[model samples]
Target: MSIQCPSCNSQRIITRDIARKLGGTTGAIAGGASGMAGAAGGARVGTLVGTIGGPLGMTLGGLAGAIIGGLVGSAAGGAAGAKLGEEIDNKVLDNFQCANCGHCFRQQD
Candidate 1:
């Protein structure tokens, strides 16, 4: 769909996406925090498996597990947040800017 500025009636428009960016960051932080549980579980499993090799292997395994768990959680959370933010941007926020006049407006249905 084409976007036009209400004030200038200019066809040059851009999306601000302010909420999407914020939501992704916030969601990532929250997801990482929640992932601590996953990390702990991963560590336990990794340590058990690494036991065959000894202390050094166990240490490495635990570290790897924690990192992987946290990363996975953050990724998942970020995606969810971005989706929600996009919806908000489209439906509730004035997410578009007119490149010609610097006007911000929401798209009308």
Candidate 2:
């Protein structure tokens, strides 16, 4: 269902899941905070929250949420990223590997 990295056979690829988790958690916290604030100010908090939850909602919150999300995601994804890298590395190892040099390479016609 997914394409493996040409250099690595890893299926554990970086995907929207990572982004979504990072983005979602951040969006929720920030949106919730701002939504609460806007609600207090007589604006439609629900609308703002909805918007915050849409299309990288963190974007709406600006750099603060983004930086926070990135840091959190990076930390959370470190092990996951390594796992993905390992899986890709294994895949690359399996798919490539020059018969002569013991080096991993893509097959070419």
Candidate 3:
């Protein structure tokens, strides 16, 4: 069930690390932005929730909100980043040339 190079039928295929790096970097950026947005929304909600507890309650609520928001955001970001990385590997990185034959081809899934 191993991937064979189409041109030379060689199994010495190597994955390109750069594709994962690029995909992960892009994913991190996207995740960070979404996380920030989540934090802002959470803070607003927390503020309202804390209203019942007074100023002290408000502070606690905001802190809790921020923590929860950050966790959720980070989880979502990581998942998205991993998916993007896989896509990059599949679509782009899989097209590496075989060292033995110097033939460029996509890896068989």
Candidate 4:
């Protein structure tokens, strides 16, 4: 769909997803912080399992577990955050700008 400026009728428009960007970043950080606990648990389990294969296996297993846990948390958080941000953009923020006239407006439903 083409978005035109309500004030100027200009078709040149830009999107400013301020909330989305901020939300995603904040959520990722929060999720990663929380993921630390998950990582610790994963590491413990990995270490226990790895012990059967000796020292190298234990080290690799722990590292892999921690990394996976952190990544999963970060990804989940980012997705959730982005969705929330999108809602804010649509309903609360003036998310569109007319490039030709520099007028900011909310998307019209």
**RMSD values, in order shown:** 1.3, 13.8, 3.3, 1.0
3 or 4, greater by lDDT = 4
How does each model score on lDDT? 0.88, 0.45, 0.74, 0.88
Q: What order do you get sorting by lDDT, best first?
A: 4, 1, 3, 2
lDDT of 4 at 33: 76
lDDT of 4 at 104: 98
Query: What is the C-alpha lDDT profile of model 1 across 1-109, one tens digit per residue?
Result: 8888999999999999988998898888878877777889888888888788899989988888888888888888888888888889999999999999899999898
For 1-109, candidate 2 gives per-residue lDDT tens digits of 5545555455443332333444445555555555444444333333355465774553444444444444554455454545554455444434444333344443333
Q: Runs in model 1 with CA error above 4 Å? A: none
Q: Work out the TM-score per prediction.
A: 0.90, 0.29, 0.66, 0.94
Clashing pairs in 2: 9-91, 9-92, 10-87, 10-88
Candidate 4's residue-wise lDDT over 1-109, tens digit each?
A: 9998999899999999999998898888878877777899888888888898899889988987888888888888888888899889989999999999899999878
Count of backbone collisions within predicted model 2: 4
Q: lDDT, candidate 4, residue 46?
A: 80
Task: Output the lDDT of residue 75, model 3.
Answer: 67
In candidate 1, position 48 carries an lDDT of 82
> How many residue pairs of model 3 clash at the backbone?
0
Worst 10 residues of 2 by lDDT: 38-47
- Give the TM-score ranking, best first: 4, 1, 3, 2
lDDT of 1: 0.88
